[model samples]
Target chain A: MKKNKSDLIRYLFFLSAILSIALIILISFFLFKEGTVIFKEVGFLNFILGKDWSPTNTPSSFGILPMILGSLYITLIAILIGGPVGIITAVFLVYYTKDKHYRFLKSIINLMAGIPSIIYGFFGMVVLVPAVRYLFPSNGNSILTAGILLSIMILPTVINLSEVAIRAVPRFYYEGALALGSSKERSIFKVVLPAAKSGVISSLILGIGRAVGETMAVVMVAGNQPRMPKGIFKGARTLTTNIVMEMSYASGVHRNALIGTAVVLFMIILIINLVFTIFKERNVNG
Target chain B: MSKIKIKDFNLFYDNFQGLKNINMNIEENKITAFIGPSGCGKSSLLKSINRMNDLVDSCVTNGNIYFDDKDIMKTDVTQLRKEIGMVFQNPNPFPMSIYNNIAYGPRTHGIKSKEELDKIVESSLRKAALYDEVKDSIHKSALKLSGGQQQRLCIARALAIEPEVLLLDEPTSALDPISTLKIEELLQSLKDDYTIVIVTHNMQQALRISDNTGFFLNGELIEFNETDKLFTFPENEKTENYITGRFG
Candidate 1:
């Protein structure tokens, strides 16, 4: 009788686990069926490398190179700004701050993560748009403004993960460095931080995924120009922003093209996840 | 000549006393081993020599530790540690290359030239008797080495700083007999150039390696004497009981 109940519980867990995988497979099947349809109208090579995206023009061109470049460039800027700040802030929290202040500082970072992305988008539109406008004299929605906002959005993720990685390094390494007469900063940077390298790099990888997949916050500030980004200050549309901005008004082939852009975005994130897994594996062995 | 002098030392962790008043003179160019049961404050006293206990917030010491006739507590901590190196119980080689692990101490002291670092690395590894085993793969990660070799690499790393004294806290407690014998032989050779102090749980290790031995029980120093004399003819009843494998 007990074995019967245990078997039932095991089946319930197995069903829940398989259900998530089934849903993912179903979604991927639909996405591929719809996404590949647009390739029939616009040749695959032309669609990927095409510099222009005019979905509503006469015989609309379906090139998405500009959106890909936009995604790549903006994610670069966010990593540049957020990566160092988060890693260093984590080092400070783990090595420098006392228990009392560390708790308070940790909660503030957690609060930043809890904020909704749409609220962040609203903030970028209201404050960052005007600030950039005052500086660059454009309507203020540009690649730079969106990138800066996204960097802030990724900070909580980078800091929290980096902190966990740095904290996970055994205490003995730090003490060993100190015993060699290394200073506090030297011990942390040279010994403690290096020991936590794989974990720290994984944190940045996760941050890049977050920045690349961001759509709603980016669309409001990127100006949706659909042109190849000429400079940091110029307006642009990322692969993600392109989909969200056009999916509402898009129809037929145009709607499929938006989904095709998603397929590209999905590939980018999949590659990022693959790199993350490889790193984690190397960390275990090496 | 004395390498270190501890006078009327007492250590407290918040309200709890960790070590009672202790006084001892550690001779230069000799191996001094502290032996005791667990939690007997021998490790605490050894940590005090290098001011390592300063890392503990609640730890307080009332005493003077004189190194080369200068006050140790008043010396700058970085400078103190540079002159007095340490090895821990567990082998902790920084996750970098073996060459880098050995060079890290010298580099921290502002030695930048690769030529000088190569010299220091080779010499320190030789001093720790670990060069020939790791010379070909010196660039490989230090963590890849065997446990005993890793501990020797740590010793080589401590030697790289050219410290006048080395403090070891139960360094061989985790090692097999062969590795323990190798370290004992290495210490015999090292005493000509470096002042060595070790804390041990194994009374046999103390007899085999150390020139002088100090026995402690319940945070108090019960006896300090020559290793041969102390183990063969312990003056204190508690010391005899501990060394004889008869516990009260």
Candidate 2:
């Protein structure tokens, strides 16, 4: 009887593993089934590189080139601003912060991560949009504004992950450098940071994933125009924003095209994850 | 002449005494070994010379350490540390090409010229007796080297900075007998150019390499004497017990 019970438990564990794989298969199955219809009507190249996205027009052109460019540009700006700041902040937290203060600051950053997306969206709409408008003399809604907001939103992930990576470096490296008459700053920057390079890079990749997938806040601050991205000061629309903006009212081929936008977004995130996995594997092997 | 003078030095870590009142003078360009059981404060005194104990937040000390005539506390910490290099029990080579690891210290001291760095790298590696072995793979990641090679690489790295005193805390405890012998030989050669202080638990290592040896028990220096006399002659019962392997 005990053996049978243990076997049942073993089977149950196997069931959980299969269950997760099944869930992923189900999700991809639905996405491809619904999203592939637009490809047949619009053709893969036209749908992907299409410039015009007037889904409500007579013939309804569904080119997503502008949204693609917008997503890439906005994500680029976020990383450009957030990457160095997050990494530097993590180094500071690891080397400088007092024990009690470090705990407080780390938890506060964790709280920031736990904050809902709508709050960020609301904050960006009310405060950041106005600030950018005052500074740039635009409608206050543009790729630059959205990128800045996304950068703020992604800070917690980048800082927390980078901090973990930096702390994982052995202390003797720092000590050995100091003993060599290298200053504390030099030791941390030269020896320690390089040792933690893989971790830092993966942190930035995760931040990129979050930035590219961000929708509500980008839609609020990015001026959500369904055209190709222009200058930094001009408005833009992203893949995620396009899907979220019209998914509710969209029907038939238009709705399917929105799902196609989701399919593309999923691919980008999967690629980022694969790159992150490669970095992690390399670190382990070395 | 003495290279470093310590007078009435005491170290405490959060109310726990690490090193009780200590006084010693290390001779110039000679190897001085501190031998004791674990937690007896030999490593603490070695770290004190370079002000490395400053990294320990709870650790506090009130003492005077003099490098030649100048007080180390009054000297610029960065400048002081540059003159006093250290190596630890475990070999810690930075995860970079061997050339970059050796160049790190000189670059920090503002040696930016490529030719100058190349010259320093070669000379330092040669001094540590590592240049010939690593010549072909100088651009390879330092982490790829064997245990003894890594330790030698660390020594080469320390030499690159052109420090006056080299402090090693149980530098060979983690190595095999052969690697240990190689490092002991390297230190013998190193002493002619730089003042050397080593904290060791190995009594034979002290007898073999050190000119002067200090024996510690609990938190105090039990006896300080010439290596031969300290091992051969009768002085403190504790030193005798430790050397005879009766107790540590």
Candidate 3:
């Protein structure tokens, strides 16, 4: 009787494990099924590289080049701003900060991760927008503003993962450097940081993912202009922002185009995750 | 002449005493061995010479350690460490190429010319007796080397800086018999140019390579004498018991 019960429990657990994979497959199937319709209506190249994104006119154009450029630009700028700050902060936490202060600061960083994205959006709209307007030449809602806000939003992920990576390095490497008469800073930068290279890189890549997928906070700051990104100070719309802004009232080909936008975004995420996995595997093997 | 002198040195980790009122004089260009059971503070005393004990948050030290008649506590720590290099119990070559690992110390001390670094790298590896084996694979990652080769790479890394004294903590304890013999022979050759201090659990190893031996028990130095005399005729009962394989 006990053996039968144990077998039933094992089968149930196996079912639960398979259920998540099944859901992922279902979601991907649904997305592709709906998303491919736009490619049929508009050639894939024309839809992707058309440059013009007019969906409401008599003969609408459905080029996502502008939104793609905007997303790429925003993600690049955000990583540029956030990557160094996050890595340096992580290094400080692991090597420099004392125990008591480290605990307190770590908790604060964890709390930052938990705050809602809506709250971040509200904060960006009220605080960062006005600050950018006051300090810079452009209006409150611009690519620069969105980039700044997105960088802030991605900080928690960058800091936390980089910290874990840096700390994961064996203590002996640091001791070895010290034994060689290297300074503490030299040891950390030259030995410890290099040892944690793949981890730090993955952190930046994950941060880029967070910045790319961010919608609510970005929309609040970015002007949502569906055009090619003009300059750092000019307004633009990312792929995510374009979909979120028009999904409510979009119809027919327009709705499909938006879903098509999601497909592109999904591809971008897939590439980022692929790069992360490659680096992780190399680190493990080497 | 004495290269290092420990005067009434006491060490504590928080409130727990690790080394108690230790005093010793280490001679220049001689291999001095510290033998003790586990947790008896032999490694602690070795670490104190290079001020590695400073890394421990709760570690406290009383009394002065003089290197070349100058108090080490008052000297700049980085400078002190440069003068006194250490090898850990575990071989920990940096996760970098063997060539780069040797270059790290010289680079830290501001040697930037590639040709000069190359020369130093070759000479250091030669001194550690690892050059002939790893010469063709200089750019290969140190982690790829065997355990004994990695330990030798670490020795080459320490030798790159041209330190006056080398302190090793159970360096061969992790190696097989042949690897252990290789290291013991390497230390024998190194002692002519560098003052050597080693912490070992093996009494036979101490007798074979060391000129002087200090036997420690329960955070105290129970005996210190020439290795030949100490092994043949121990003055302390505890040292005799330890050397006789009676009890730790």
DockQ of each: 0.83, 0.83, 0.87
lDDT of each: 0.92, 0.92, 0.93
Which clashing pairs does model 2 show? Answer: A50-A63
How far residue A55's Cα lies from its native spot in candidate 2, in Å, is 1.3
TM per prediction: 0.96, 0.98, 0.98
Cα lDDT for residue B221, model 2? 93
**Per-residue alpha-carbon lDDT of model 2 for A87-196, expressed as tens digits?**
99999999999989999998988998999888998999999899999998898899999999999899998999899889989998888888777888989998899899
Per-residue alpha-carbon lDDT of candidate 2 for residues B39-98, written as tens digits (9 for 90 to 100): 999999999999999899999998799998789989888898889888888999988899
Docking quality level of the chain pair in candidate 3 = high
Rank order by lDDT, top first?
3, 1, 2
Model 3, B93-193: lDDT tens digits are 99999999999999999999999999999999999999999999999899999999999988889999999999999999999999899999999999999
Native-to-model Cα distance after best TM-score fit, residue B5 in candidate 1, in Å: 1.6
Off by over 4 Å in 2: none
Give the poorly placed runs of model 3, Cα more than 4 Å off: none
Candidate 1 per-residue lDDT, tens place, B1-248, comes to: 89999999999999988899999999999999999989899999999998999899899999899999999989999999999999999999998999999999999999999999999999999999999999999999998998889999999999999999999999888898888888889988999999999999999899998999999888899999999999999999889998999973
Q: Who wins the lDDT comparison?
A: 3
Sort by TM-score, best first: what order? Answer: 2, 3, 1
